[model samples]
Target: MTGRELLRMVAAQVCVHGVMTGTRLAAPLLALQIGYSAAQVGVMLALFALSPVLLALSAGRLADKHGLRLPMHLAIGGATLGAGIAAIWPIFPVLCVSALLTGAAAATTQISMQRHVGRAAKNTSELKAVFSWMAIAPALGNFLGPLIAGVVIDHAGPEPAHEWGFRAAFAVLALMPLITLWLLRGAHEAPPEPSEEAPADRSVWDLLSVPQLRLLLLVNWMQSAAWDVHTFVVPILGHERGMSASTIGVLLGVFAAAAAAVRVVLPILSERVPEWGVVLVSTVVAACALVAYPLTPGAVSMGVCSAVLGVALGAVQPMIMSVLHQITPPNRQGEAMALRIMTLNFSSFLMPMLFGSLGAVLGVSGLFWLIGGLLVVGAPSVKGLRVDETPHERPGDPR
Candidate 1:
């Protein structure tokens, strides 16, 4: 892809991501004001993730069979409508429906864009650069989304008024994705060429049977669980700590900024260290960060811990995407990306409810400790990514 096209794609992603992240944070807060318990909050978030988990593979197949543009358009429309629904009604049941729509739309839109970028790359170098660039967009969104929502919520002040604050936040964010359509106008990326030798009946299971791909997906799930827990738990933790809504948002933003800063130099970091090494270290750092997270006595300490956790978790995505693309069949790259999304959303779907229930009994600190322990248990999965087995390079080739 040309630099201009890449920039356009990233610009579009920033808006979509902002809505996704902003809504994610805002939704729970809204539900709490609506008088939902922590377990209820988990159920609400699970419903939000349901569509994405169910539809991810099909969305990928559609992108592969047709083109990226249609899916992108559909995604933007669905997300916009979903956000508008939440803004208009501001009820738990309606918010649940909104979550489903937004989740599916965001997953499809992201898969389409990822497929487009994967198709555009000419080699390993370009793939690394593009994926790294793409990573920064989410970092920006993660920061801006909640930051904006928190300020609005804080400004609204107190219960009933702050409820309107959330409604207004969703309404404002619903419009952001419209900018994506404008940015991507006239942007064209042809689908990947068909492979004549490939069998027509190849199934997802066949793809999953690959040891490395399977291992990558599993490790990805572990890391993704860590990411989800932080997003879900932080606001609750902040609220319990007597912090304001804006401080909670800033805490999440700090994590995102640290993540973005790491991605800014990821290409260079990947060159110096193998992908496996980076992932392994990330897992350890994430474990350590999670352990420290609940121990923070105040917001500054919590922010410091968030930055550390962000750095650890942030480094994993681009590396995993680059490696996953390298390992999968060229024509099935879209499918592989969908599978990744499925894994992520599936984790997003259930982990929150599970953790929230645990937090209700064990408290937020115990929830953090449990997540940290899980990360340590899952860290060995990263070792499965042998450098020699990675596609597109020699065993000792520097990434």
Candidate 2:
């Protein structure tokens, strides 16, 4: 794809992701507005995350067989419809259902998007650059989604009006998918290049048996958990340290901003640092930041830790995608991508509950130390990763 085409595609995908993220964030808030307990809100979030896990493989298979075009259309349509229904109904059950539908749709679209980018790449350079560019979509979406939802709800006035604000946010999110649809119009997409080495009848288990792929998943999951824990733990730690809500929010915002900044420099970094080296350095840096996070004396110190953590965590995604594509067969790239998504969503579903309980018992400080410890234990998983095996190149070749 040309630079202009890549930009247009990224813009559309980012908007759709923004809608999904916005809608996902709004659903739990809507449930809370209607008087649901925190436990119930957690359940709703779990259901949303769990939907992606259950459907990921099927979605990948569909993409591999039929290509991303039809699946993207269907997934985006479901997402749009789900948001519209939540907008029209504005009730808890409808909101839960909306979350599930949107979640499934978003997962499918992401797999398709990965496959789409994989198709566009002719070498490791393009793959790393493209995937790095794609990583910005979610970061942008995650930031925009909650910000838009919060702004709309705030503008809607006091409690009763705030309910309408949530509804309006969903309405607004629903419109983004339409823009994605428009972007899809008249745009030519490259189909994935067929691979002679990929068997036509590979099972999901077959893919998992590869040692390097398993290592990739492990590294990917560890990094994903770090990202989640940082987001979840920072506010709690900040509050414990007597920081105001706004101060903590700004700290989180800085972390996010740092992440976005790192992506801009990622292509250059990828060129110099091998993929395995990047993952190893990021893991070590993230662990160091986590150790510093709970021990920071004040907001400024904590913000510095958060920014370092964000940069470390931020550099991970594109490398994972590039390595994953390298290890899997070209034709089965969708399944490989799905496996990565499945592991991440699985982490999303389970980590919060596990860590929340741990935090309650051991305190947030203990929890941070525990995460750092776990990263230390798992450090060897990435040790086996072959940094020289650039995606789109044959094994052991120095191309």
Candidate 3:
């Protein structure tokens, strides 16, 4: 693909992911609108995540073997349709089903894009920069999604305004995948070669022979769990603290803005900072911030904590992808990345439910504290990732 086409693809993905990030605001309120309990919301989140978990590997393999455009088109259509359905009538059960459809669409988009990024990128540094910048769209989306959704939900007046609220929000989201499908059309297809270990019988264990791959995958899973717990926990926390839906929306916006800002500069900064050091220090600090969040006096204090935590959350994806690109060859990148996504997503299902149930018993403060401790536990595992594993192109020098 030409550089222009590549950039167009990236732009399209930004829109797609931006809407995806923006839609995060929709779910909590959608739960509330439908009168689903916190536990049910957690379950819905898990079930949604599970769709991606199940499909991630196969999606990646398919992208590698075929063209990204076709699967990407399908995924975008699915997401658009799913968003449309969820907005229709907003019943509790319908929303849950919408979660499943949305999750599948999101997972497919992820795999298709990653495969394209790997294929289209000219070098390791460019790849890292692209992935890091790719994250910026989500942060911007987060800011936009909740702020807009909140206005529609809180201020929009008519009969059945809540339904109007989500319909408006989802209508915006449905537009994103079309952009992705259109942009993907311009991308040059790079079909992957059969792997050296392409035997039909290769077990997951056998396929994951690289030591770094295993470690990275596991750390990412833990990271995902902690991240998800915070996502579900934050809204519930706000409810307990008596914040309105609009206020919660603003906080989510701030958090996402912080995350986006950090990610925008990450690729440039990675050259100067150690890759593992970046991940480690940020994660540790984020954990401390999260631990303090619920204990804070009120919304303002917690908002500060959430923003700090967002800064840390922003650091994760590019750094992890950098490390992944470093160790895995291009041909295996698809499967490896797919596995990483799957593991992260599978954890997304359980962590929210686990944390929410515990919070019901222990209270929000206790839940945050527990999640904080869990983040602490995760920090060490990720912190120690060997720098020697970095790809030769962008060896993030620790010093």
Candidate 4:
């Protein structure tokens, strides 16, 4: 893809994914405002990830077969409808449904987009650069979504109910996905390679037999759990500390902004930086930051911690994606990407509820330490990853 086309793809992703991210903030806060318990709110948050866990493999296979156009259309429609439902209803039950819709939509968009972009690269360097550029969508979406929702929630009205504020935020989120549809106008889909098709007898599980891919997924799960803990716990922690909606949003936004900032520079350094080294350092830093997160005393201190964690986690995806595209086969990349999404969302689906129940007993600080400790344990595995190796190549085989 040309730079302009690549940028358009990124913009499209930001719009669609932003709807999901924005709702993630707005819905949980609304439930909390309505006096739901953190555990209940956790259930609601878990719903966002639920559909993706079940549907990701199907979505990936769909992308592999149909390419971007069909999948993007489905994603745009689902996200728009999902947020619109919450905008109209604005209740806990409706919000759960919205979460399911938007989460699944975001996952579908990501698989299709990532597969498309990975295929566009001519070499490993381009793969790194392209994925780095694409990875910024989530960070930017995270920043924009929460910032918008938080500001609207804080200022939409003085109505004692705070109902209008949340409704307005959902309404705004509903419209954001339309921009993605517009940006995708006239986009081209590459013709499928006959050899790229997996046989009907093939199962997605076979991809896991590759040792490098398995290690990568394990490391990714650890990093993703850290992210889930931050996203799931921060609001509860901030709420317990009696911070305002805007303050919490800004804290989350700072993390995303830091993430986006790091990604902006990653493309420039893609040639110099080894993907494995970056992943290793990022994993270590993220572990440390998560451990330190709960100790921050106030918004400023928490924001500082958030930024540090953001930078560490933000640098991870491009490297992982680059290495992933290198190690996996060209034909089955979608299944591999889907498998990664399934694993992460499975954690996302469970971790919040797990965090909620655990948070009730151990407190949010303890939850942070738990994930951080796991990452520390997993850090050594990063040393084994090498992009030069592929799943198809047996040990000691001639190139």
Candidate 5:
């Protein structure tokens, strides 16, 4: 892919994914504003991830069969429709539906984009660089979406309730994905690999038999759980501390900005840095940050913790994607990406409710420590990871 095309892809990602990110912030805060318990909001947040768990494999197969255009169109439509529904109704049930729709759409768009970019790269260094660029999309989306939603929520209407503000935010989010369609107008879709036609008997489960992929998935899950914990718990923590919606949004936005900043330099550093080394360091740093998170006394301190955590987690995806594309078969890349999304979203779907229940008993501090402890325990396993500078697929190898 040309640099311009790559940028268009990233912009498209920001638009579609931003809609989901904004909705995630808006829905939970609205639920809380309406006097719902944190547990209830957690259930609502879980809905955002639920569709991905159920539909990721099918989405991946679609990407493999049809390439980026078809999946992108479907994803754009789903996101637009979801946000539109919530904009009109702004009810709890409709918000849940919106979450499912937007989440599934974002995940599908991500799979198609990742598969396309991975296929475009010629070597390991290029893989890392491209994915590092691609990783910026989420960070940018996360930052812009929440920052926009928060500002709109705080200022768009007479306060105490901000019902109008919430609806307005949803309407804005509903329109963001349309920009993606325009940005991708002239983008090229690469032809599918010959081996894309996998036999009907092949199962995604078979990919797990590879020990490296298995370990990578485990590490990815740990990182994903850490992310979910922060996303789900931070708003509750802020609310409990009497922080305003805009403050909480800025806090989360700061995290995303920090993440994006790290990724911006990663492409330049891709050749010099070892992917495994980056992962190991990020794992350790993320654990430390999560442990420190609940100890912060104010928004500034919490923002500091969020920035630290963002930098740690932000550096991880490019390395993971680089290793993943290298290790998985070319024809099965979409399926492999799907499998990774399924694993991460599965935890995302359940972890919020688990965090809510556990936080009520253990407190937010305990939840952070629990996840942090897991990351610490899992950090050493990164040592076992190895990536080939040039990986060749073996003929007839099931992997």
Candidate 6:
């Protein structure tokens, strides 16, 4: 992709991702205001993730069979409508429906963007770089979105903070995607048309047929599940531990910035290291950090561990995306990308409620200890990557 196109895509990524997940942090607050218990709050968050987990592959197949722009446009509309629903009504059933729509919209957005990026990426390394650099967008967006929401929540009541904030955020999600469409104006579609060379069966199940692709999806699933533990659990943990709202906000911003900073250089660094090797090392590093986090002296020490955790955690998605791009045919990029999203969302969807229950049983420190242990157990799963892996994109395909 041209630098200009890259910039536009990154910008859209930032806006959509920032809003979609930033609301996750606000969910507990919303739940509390709406008369839900802590467990209910976690359940609410996890419930939203179900559609993406179950349906992303089909969405991907649709994108693959058809095209990228159409799904993306529809996703933007879904996001807008979903957010509007939340803004207008904060009743129990409405919140559930709105959250589900938001989750579906997020899936729609991911399928479109990943397919575009996968089709556009010239090589495995470039794909990795594009995915990694794209992290900067959401990393930045996560920082801004919460701060904006926090300000609104603190000023407006908690109800307005969540209900209206989602409305405003989705309104912005709608506008940002529109700008990306405008920027991509006159840009021809890059996903390949089906021919004898590419398989005609581009179903979600087709996404599962390839063993190498299956491994990649597993990696995506595990990595997302690991990250969700922190994203959904940390604020709750912080609140329980007597951390101030401002401090929680500051720590979150720091973590996002740290993650972006690490990702900025990972694209170049990934070139020098074998992809599988990078995964191995990153997992180990992240595990060590998480293991240390619960044992740390306090928040200062915890933030330090969190930054280290960010560096390690931020590397996984791009590495997997790069590999997925390599194994997938250009024509099937949408299916492959959507399949990964589906898997990731599926593993993550149940995390919040499960973790909340565990947290309730185990206590906050106990929850962190369990998280640390899970990472340790997951370390052994990082075996060698596919045998035919290419280190970088070859010029034959088109850069």
Best by TM-score: 2
**Least accurate 10 contiguous residues by lDDT in model 6:** 390-399
Give lDDT tens digits, candidate 4, residues 1-399.
Answer: 799999999999999888999999999989998889998997887887888898889888888778888988999999999999998999899999999999999999999999999888887789899999999888778778887888888888686328998998899999998899999997777666655655666677667778988999998888888888888889989999999999998988888788889998888777887898898899899999999989988999999989999899989999999888878766677778999999988877677668889888988899999999998998989987766643466221233
Per-prediction TM-score: 0.82, 0.92, 0.79, 0.84, 0.86, 0.82
Inter-residue clash pairs, candidate 1: none
Best by lDDT: 5
Q: Local error of candidate 1 at 285, Å?
A: 2.1
Superposed model 1: Cα runs more than 4 Å off: 22-42, 84-94, 146-172, 194-200, 232-250, 292-302, 357-369, 387-399
Query: What tens digits encode model 6's per-residue C-alpha lDDT throughout 199-247?
Result: 4443456556667777776666656665777676668767867899887
How much lDDT does each candidate structure score? Answer: 0.82, 0.82, 0.70, 0.86, 0.88, 0.67
- The runs of at least 3 residues in candidate 2 whose Cα sits more than 4 Å from the true structure, single-residue gaps closed, are 156-160, 191-201, 387-399
Residues 47-160 of candidate 3 have per-residue lDDT tens digits of 667888888887777665565766777777777777777666566776666677677777777667766766666765676676777666545544554566566665554643
Candidate 1: count of backbone clashes, pairs at least 3 residues apart or interchain: 0
Query: What is residue 211's positional error in candidate 1, in angstroms?
Result: 1.1
Candidate 4 structure, TM-score to reference: 0.84
Better of 2 and 3 by lDDT: 2
C-alpha lDDT of residue 153 in model 6: 59
Candidate 5 structure lDDT: 0.88
Please give the lDDT score at residue 145 for candidate 3: 47
